[model samples]
Structure formats: C-alpha cells, structure tokens
Target: MKILNPFRLGLLGGLGVLVAVGIGQTVISLATILTYVGAALFLALGLDPVVTWLETKKFPRWTAILTVLAGVLGVFTGLIFAIVPVIAEQVRNAVQATPRLVTAFFDGTVRENVETALPWLGVQDLLDGFNEWAADLDVTTIGGGVFAVGIGIATGITGAIIVLILTIYFVSSLNGIKSGIYQLVPATKRAKFIDLAEQVSAAVGRYVIGQGSLALVNGVLSFIVLTLIFPAFGLPVKYSALLAFIAFMGSLIPLVGTLSGSIVITLLVLLFNGSPSVIAVGIYYLVYMQLEAYVLNPRIMNKAVKIPGALVVIAALAGGTLLGILGALIAIPVAAAILIVVQQVIIPRQADL
Candidate 1:
C-alpha cells in the first residue's frame, strides 16, 4: 500500500473482471450444468442396485460399469431407431396436411358450430387475425426458423451424449467419489451426510424408474386406443402410432402437458377426419386421465415416489413457468430430492438439536 504496487493492482483488477464475467455468464451456464449433473446423478442412482448386485457377485467395479453403460446405450439406440422414423413421418404428414385441415375445419360444419357457440367470442375475427399472421409468415422465414431449431436440437443432443458419457464415468467411480467427498467433511458429520446422500439418491432413482414404467404403460395404452378409434373415424392410420407416442411424451410433463397433447392430437384428428373425431379424441383423453390419476399413478408411482398430488401440480407449474418442457419433466424428481432431504436430514437434525 505504501508503494502502491502496479503489478498487484493489475492482478486485483483482472480478478475483479473475471468475477464479473462469471456472474454475467452464470444464468446461461447454470441451467445446463444443473441439468447434466441431475441427469448423471439420477442415472447413477438407478444403476446402484445393479452395481450392488455385481459387487455381491465379486464382479470388478469397472466391469460392472461397462455392463451398465452398454445396457443404457443399447436401450437408447433401440428407442431412437424404433421411434424416430415414426415421429418424423407423422411430423411430415402433419405439416403437409395443415392447410387442408384449416380449410376443411373453417369451411365445413365445424365453422357453423363455432359461429353459433362463439358468436360473441369473435371466433372469426380471431381466425382472421391468425390468417393475417400466417400471411406475414413467409416460407423463407418459417424454413429459417425450422433450420435454427434443428441446429439447437442437434446441439442439445450432442450435449446429452456428453452428459451420458460423464454419467457412466461418474457412476463407475461413485464409491471412490463418495469416500473423497466424505473425507472433506468433519468426521462427526461425514456419516450423516453420507446417509442423507443415499436417501436422496434412492428417492431420485426410484422416481426415475417409476416414471419410465408409467410412461411406457401410458404410451402402450394410448397406441391401442388410437389405433382402434382412428379407423372408425376414417383418418390416416399411419399416423396413429406417432400421435400416440407424442401424447405419451406429453403426458410425462405432469398437469399441463397432457392437456397440451390432447389439444394437438384433437387438432390432428379434426384436420384429417372431422369435428366428431375431435370430440371423440377429447372424450378418450378425459377418460384416460381419470384412469391414470386413479389407477396407474397410485399403483405404480406410490412405491417409488410418494409425492402429494397438490405438490406435484405446484412443482410442475413452477418448473414449466421457469424452464418450459425440460423443467416440467424434471420437476417431480427435484421435488422428490427435496422431500428426501427434508425428511431424512433437516427435520431430524432440528429434532436432535
């Protein structure tokens, strides 16, 4: 301070700038890192049972890790190959038929129904505004937008792949990692922290496995129902599976996701066949939701994640509001993790004190 060292001043200034930049960039990087870490942790937790079994059987940790990674890769590849083409075809057909669907719906009996029901609602005015908006949306603009979205999806997929690789590595070394982390804690606190971590890991793992099973059941049930109903309505049969899959994915989003999916599917049905089909599809979804809420959810999810219905809805809404689809997908698991921490650590610690 007496000499006012220029070198020290420069170093301090550089450090300040770096800290500013980190703070500025944190919002962008925070979500990405959280997502990757959450995914990896969940994956490791899910495979913990298998790892334990392997250890019991005297399998080397590296070998068990390789086996788990291979299984995961195989499942992912199979799903991609089996599902992507069907979805791609449905998307292509849906795009091609959009104008026809719009024309038919507006020109046909549906228009009369809308006119009658929504006379005061200015339904036609809304359509007119939509048309105006569509007119302003040129092909080049739409195409450019689609291209940009495609690039973003590709980048996301690449990031997911990297995360998956990291997950495998982390899972393989989970024991070592846990030991190292515990060592950093005071000896008195280490055991409690380790126990809390295990509880959290178990909660998240069970939730993931349960959700996957539920999604599969939903998908299968939807496909069966759509396949049966589409033919009676005289819509394109080829798109049924694709539509069902979309609905299945959407159902994973908790509250609003199913509703959004139902709307999209109903529109597709209306586009191809008519309003009667749309009404039928709506009825089907309503019934499906009832069954899922009452039967499937309780039977399947109860064992894995015992979240309250109100909490699930609240978490889903908050997550969707904050981060869109990805947020919604992860909201339940995050809530489960928090619940475990509260039940196993915080509450007990408070009680002890």
Candidate 2:
C-alpha cells in the first residue's frame, strides 16, 4: 500500500487514452452528417429573404417557403435534364477535336478572327504563344488533366444531389430549427443572442442573394457568348447549355473564381473552338469582371457585409481548404458574419472594459 500503487495509476491512464480514442472516432463518424446539416443551414439562410419578402406581400409563411423550394427544385431538375445531353456532346466533341484544334490554330486561317477578337495579339504571335506554351507539355500530363477533370465533375454532381435533399428538409423546418437553437442558449443571454443571430443572418442572407444574382448573370452570359462564338469558328456550341452551370460555380469564389474558370474555358475553347475563340471568351470576362467589381457589386451588395479585398481572398482560400468548393462559395458570407460580430460585440465590450 505504501509503494505508491503504480499499477492502478497505469491502469487509469490507459483507460483515459481509450476514452479519448473513442471520442475521436465518434467525431469522425459524425462528420458526414454534420456536413449535410451545414449545407442545409447555409442554403436555408440564403433562401430566407425571398421567403420573408413573399410573406410581407400577404402570403402564409409555409406557402412562401414551399413556393421558393418548388421553384428551386423544379429549375434544378429541368437544368439537369437539359444539361445531360449537352455535356455528353461536349465531352465527345472535346475528345474528337483535340488534334484538329492544335493544327487549325497554327494554320493561319483563323488568324484574322483571332486578331479581331483580341487586337492586342497578332495571329502569328497567338499560335507562337501556344507553341511556346506547349513546348513544355507532355502527353501524359494532358491525359491526367482530362481524367482529373472528369473525376471532379462526377464528384460535384454527387455532392449536389446530397445538398439538394438536405436543403429541402432544412428549409421546411427552418423556423423550428431556429427556435430549438434559441432554447439551447441560457435564458439570461437568449434575447441578446437572438438579436445578434438575426443581424448576422440578415448579413449572410444579403450576401448570398447578391452572390447568386452575380452567378446568374455570369452563367447566362457565358451561355450566350459561347453559343454565339463557337459556331463562328466552325466549332459547335451544342454544349453551351452546360457551360452556364460551369460558369455559375466558377463565379462563386471572390477573386480566383474567374481565373479558375478561364483555365477551363481557355482549354475548351482552344481544343474545340480554337484559341481565337478562347481569346474572345477571355476578353469578355476581362470586361465583364471589371463591370461586376465596380457596378453590379455596388448595386446588389450595397447593404451586405463589407470586407476588404485581401480579406475576401484569404477567407475564400481558408474556407476552400477546410470544406472544398462549398466552403469557397460560402466563405464571403462567413467572413462577413465574423466582421459583424467584431464590430457589434467585441469592440463594444472592449470599450466598456
């Protein structure tokens, strides 16, 4: 008894380690469920403003919510039906046109079209540029790139289905969900928490609305532009329908959104529509992005969360790191919420202190 009971202490430590391991596994098991919940919560917040607006015009809350959900679900279902054929055609075209795209651009026939599209680059220079760029390209790398792209598209589709299912459930029970959350907070701070939560929610809602409007404009314009440009260069725009959705997702990230899209757009245009059309698409984005940054943003997000450009970039990167594309899409709104908390809560508390 006086020897310090080393065995008992060791046994207790081992049990503690086992408990910790059990807790970690529990968390890992819950991750997928949590992800679905998070997606639904964010989507419901995004749709809340439209629901509230409908209510103001004398609609019942349930009616407004259901109407919004129905419209979203209907449009998404229709879009999938419309895009399936287009994507199939596009992939087939891409696979078939790979060789022709390389030769046609360098053949001097499309040079005038290229010059007209981007006056900054001469015809010879454009082909020469591609040649110079391609000098370092390996056939293996191209094959891998195509494979990776296919995998990404497949994953995005699967994730979209899960999100759609979860979003409907969350939107249907959003009011009850919020009330339940309120009950979780201590009574002493419940009212204050509700007020803060409302403010943050409104900020996120506005941001989501603004971002969605921008994405719509981007996607529609992409479809129109690609459809018009592709045929002019003797290529097909049969898949232009699917291009809209691609542009929509690509436009969600703050700064890098268009850049990431440009790579895909350029590759597609170069491989199928020729480099001149790629330049046309590039020029279109160059102009559109400026208008978006200056005009559309000011009008749409005038009352939304305001953050610096650098912070937007950093938040998008961090969120993308944590949760993939969905994180990048919602990163701005999250950053905005944090900013609101800092201004409304932390700074005031610090001042009182």
Candidate 3:
C-alpha cells in the first residue's frame, strides 16, 4: 500500500473547511434576501385592508395599488418640499457665524468656568490653542466634505429607489409567493409553519401601523410647539415646522430614535441662533420625551407590541450590534416572531408531554 502524504491530507482538509464556510456564507446571504422579501410582503398585507376597501367600490387591484403608491409618493414629495429649504438656510447661517459664536462663548463662559474649576489648569493656554485650531480650520474644506456627502446620499437614494421598486413587485405577488413557499415544506410541518407565518405577519403589520400613527402625532405636535416658540426668539418660524417634522420621523426607531431627532433639532437650533437656542431645544426635547413615554407611547404601542420594556431595549441593542440600523429596525418584529413560536408551539408541545 502506498503511504498517504500527511501534508497533502492536511491541506485538503483545510480546503474542505474553507469551502464549507463559503457555502454557509452564501446560504446566510440568501436567507437575508428572503427575510427582506418577507418583510415587504408583510407591509403589503398591512395595506391590504385599504386595497380591499377600494376593491369593494369596484376599483381594480392595479388601480388600487397605483393609488396607494401615488399617495405615498405625494406625501414624500411634500415632506421634501417643506423641509429641505429650511434646513439649507439654517445650515448656511450656522456656518457663517460659527467663528463669532465660538469666540464669544470661550471668552465669556468657557474660560471663566475652566479657571474656576481648576486653578492649576492653564485655562488661557488651552483657549489660545482652541482658537488657533479654530482659525486653521477651513470652512471651504468643510463645505467640500459636505458636498461629497451629498453625492454619496444621492447615490444611496438611487439604490433605495431600486429596492423600493423591487419590494413593491414582491409585495404585489405576496400570496403567490407564500403559496410557493408553503409547497416546499413537508406535509406534516406545512400547516404549523403557515400558522406561524400568519402570526408573524399580523404582528409586524400592527407594529408598523401603530408606529406610523405615533410618528404622525408626534410630528404634528412638535411642529405646533416649535412654530409657537421659535418666533419669540427671532428665529425663522417657517423652518421650525420642517425641523419638527424631521425629528418626529426620526423618533420612530426604538431607543435611538428620539435622541437622533434631538440631535438634528439641536443642530438646527444652534445653526440659527447659537448656544442659547440649542439649550432651549434641549429643554423642549426633555419635556417632549417625558410626555411621549408617559402618555403617547403607552396609548399607541400598548396593544401593538406587548413585549416588555427591558426586552425591547435588549432586542434593539442586540439587533443594532449584529446588523446595524436595519437590524435595529427589524429587531422587535423578529422578537415578536420568537415570542409567538414560544407561546404557540413550544409551550403547548411541552404541556402535551
């Protein structure tokens, strides 16, 4: 018998492992694609009530779909028209006055605080270094960077449009797609899986509708408050409504949503009227957050997502860590699915035993 070479055997084993890993990665990518498809289908299901109502009045399916799409597009276009100009004007003003704001702030407040807090600290030297650094900073260079970012955002928007188109296509044929999937499962498991899928779809649909309603309410309230308060401070009132609307949309996400909204609003405030406006914005956000938590959230989200607060936080953190923003967005639905499986399948099975 010829002796096998150990080195050759070892190399072959490593190659096999690499091939397995590649295959596993490919499967994961495919699964992720399927998940996205399923999510789109669920969104369509959520919209089905509207579609059905239209059909009852003798509207064709295609016409109803077109109507829905048109409505969505109109809303988005109106939002852009309302918001972009205000933000642009505020940003321009902020950039022009940054140096003066920094000089006044350092000279009047920061220097005094630093000296009082730390007698041994070289407050004047630190201020000099900060001023030197600020002087060296080129606003033109920053503008160039912002322009590059705008280009990137344009590209991303194009990609998003493509994905939305695909999602619409998939959602339109959700029933057919689901039937095809059902046929693939073993006869014994098909019914169970179908039931599970329905539960998950319903849960996701409820969550989306509930959240959308909450966001709309929050946005309208913020806009009213900002419009009332901004004029008193000599800030542009027209833009405050736009800023508030943006903040409301941002507040749709779980833990980070309100914070992200606050950051955007704070920046806009600071841009328009410096540090004092920023401070006022902060107070507004704090009050809004408290009201939202105690009143708005409980009333809106209670029935939609029954998961505990701690679980929501954990799921959001884990999803954000594993898959970034998309993960965080889908985390609650995924958790709800798991909860359904536990309550419907595993627990019942155990009880039977």
Candidate 4:
C-alpha cells in the first residue's frame, strides 16, 4: 500500500488535468450555443407581454403562445425573403463604388465645401493624407474584408434561425420554467420572487415593444429624408431602402444605436453623394435626435420602464464597457428590473426585519 500510494496520487493528478482540459474544450464548443440560448431567453421575456395580453382576453395559454409565435415567425420569414436579395445587390454596389467614392472624396469641390462650412477646421490636409494612403492601395485589398463579411452574413442567418426556434420553445414553456425556478426558493420567499419575476418579464416585454416601435419610426424618418435629398444629390432613391434597413437594425440597440446608425448611413451618403449630402444628414439627425429624446422616447418608453436619466446613462456605459452592444441593449430594462426589486422586495424585507 505504501509503495502504491505515490503512483496512485500521480495517476489522480493526471486524470484531474485531463478533466480540466476536457471541461475547457467543452465550454469553448458550447460558447455559440450559450449565446444563442441567452438571446432566445431574452426574446422569450420580451414576448411575454403579448402572451399575457392574449390570456387576459380569455384565450388559453397555448393558444396565445402559438398565435404570437406564428405571427413573429411569419413577419421575420417575410422580411428575410424580401431583404436578403436586396442587401446582396447593395453590397455589390458598395464594392464597385468604393474606389470611385474615395476618388471623389479627395476632389477640390468637396474640399472647398468642407472648408467653407467649418472655417476654423482645415480639411484639405486631412483629405490629402487620406488620398495618398488610398492611392497606395487598390480595390482588391477589400476582397478579404468582403469575404469575411460574407461569412458573417452566413453565420448570422444560421444564428437567427436557431434563436427563433429556441425563443418559441422558451416562450411556450415560460410559465412552466418560471414555476420550476420558483420551486427552488423557500416557500416563504416564493411569492415575492414570483411577483418580482413577473414585473421583470413584463417590463422587459414592454421595453422590447417600445424599442421596436421607435426603431420603425427612426427607419421611416431616415428613409424619407434620404430619399428626398437623394434627388438633389443626384443619387437614386432605391438606395434609401438599404439605408433605412440599416438604421432600423442599428436602432434596435439602445442608447447609442441611433448615433452609430446615423454615422454609418451619413458616411455612405457622403461616399455616394458628396459633402453637401453629408451636411444634410448631419442636420437631419441633429434635429431628429432632439425630437427622439424629448418627444418620442418619453411618450413611448414612459409606460415601458422608467429608470432615472442618470441611471440609464450609467447602466448603458457600464454595459457597453463590459459586454459591448448586447449589454447596452439590455441595460435599461435590467436597471429598471433591479430598481423594481429593490423598491418592492428588498426594501420591504429590510423594513420588516
């Protein structure tokens, strides 16, 4: 036994290392799966309000769930069918136009306009450096980037399908899932947990609905402005649809989404149209951003979840810093949920004790 003890210990140590390596590999493999599941869970929470509304109307739970699921799937399927081809065509147009756009950007007309618009800001030197750098490169250099973009598109489509399926399953079983989770808590705490959970789910669902509505409005407004200006800019109106879609998708991300989307769309316009078009875009978004903040957001999001202005900014910054875009997207709702729990559950419990 004494002689065998060291050998046994070494064997166990080797086995422990193998187990650790296996666990790491398994986690890496499941990273994508976890991401899909998390996204699906968020969607399910967001859809809970629709199901609850249907239930209030005397519809059975399964009936409500199925109806909402079908409607969502139909809308998404229709959009995918309608947009995929158009986006592919736009990508081709963008690729063909890049070199030309770069050439246009360094022209005298654009330089004069930029200098005139911002008298203190010298733009010619910047343009000259960019032109020099660009002249040393060619369109073929973008091939690898385009190929990566293609791969991203393919992966995104697959991920969307998986998330959709997972979302349906999660929503259908939401009550069961909640009940199962509640069972893990002590009986005394179960009621409070259930109430808090319901509030969180409903808030999240309303936030989703409100955000979607805001995105639609933003997209429509962007499309109208871009289209009206396109004629004067000597560009076709057809490209407006692509730009609108980009705005719509981008605006789904919270806080900074509008700015990011606007910047992107504006740059593309500048590339195709000119400095004048970029100025128009800048002016439109400036006024529109004010309108969105003071008018649209207050009316729409007021009913959804009301976190203080300061908290919203802090949460968004922290989320963005920690987890990039997804974190930012969910931060406001999460903050509201936490606030609700603190006010309703935590405070009351503390007071009672």
- Top candidate when judged by lDDT against the true structure: 4
Among all windows of 10 consecutive residues in model 2, the one with the lowest summed lDDT is 267-276
Segments in model 2 whose C-alpha atoms lie over 4 Å from true places: 1-18, 99-155, 229-239
lDDT string, candidate 2, 101-204, tens digits: 55666675456555655577566766778788899899999999999999999986787788888888887888898999999999999998899899878878
TM-scores, all candidates, are 0.78, 0.79, 0.75, 0.83
The CA-based lDDT of model 3 is what?
0.73
Clash tally, candidates in order: 0, 0, 0, 0
Higher lDDT: candidate 1 or 2?
A: 2
lDDT of 1 by residue, 69-156 (tens): 7888898887789877778877898788878767766675556645543356576777789789988988998999999999999988
Which residue pairs show backbone clashes in model 4?
Answer: none
**Candidate 3 residue spans exceeding 4 A from truth:** 1-16, 24-63, 85-148, 229-238, 274-280
- Residue-wise C-alpha lDDT for candidate 4, range 209-291, written one tens digit per residue: 99989999998888777777656666444467788899999889888898889888876765565555667777888888889
Error of 3 at 166 (Å): 2.4
Q: Pairs clashing in candidate 1?
A: none
Candidate 3, run of 10 with poorest lDDT = 109-118
Q: Order the candidates by lDDT, highest first — what do you get?
A: 4, 2, 1, 3
- lDDT comparing candidate 2 with the true structure: 0.78
Q: What's the lDDT for all of these models?
A: 0.76, 0.78, 0.73, 0.83
Tens digit per residue, CA lDDT, model 3, 79-198: 578676676775676567668666756566545534444468786787789779888989999999999999999976775565566657755676687799999999999999999987
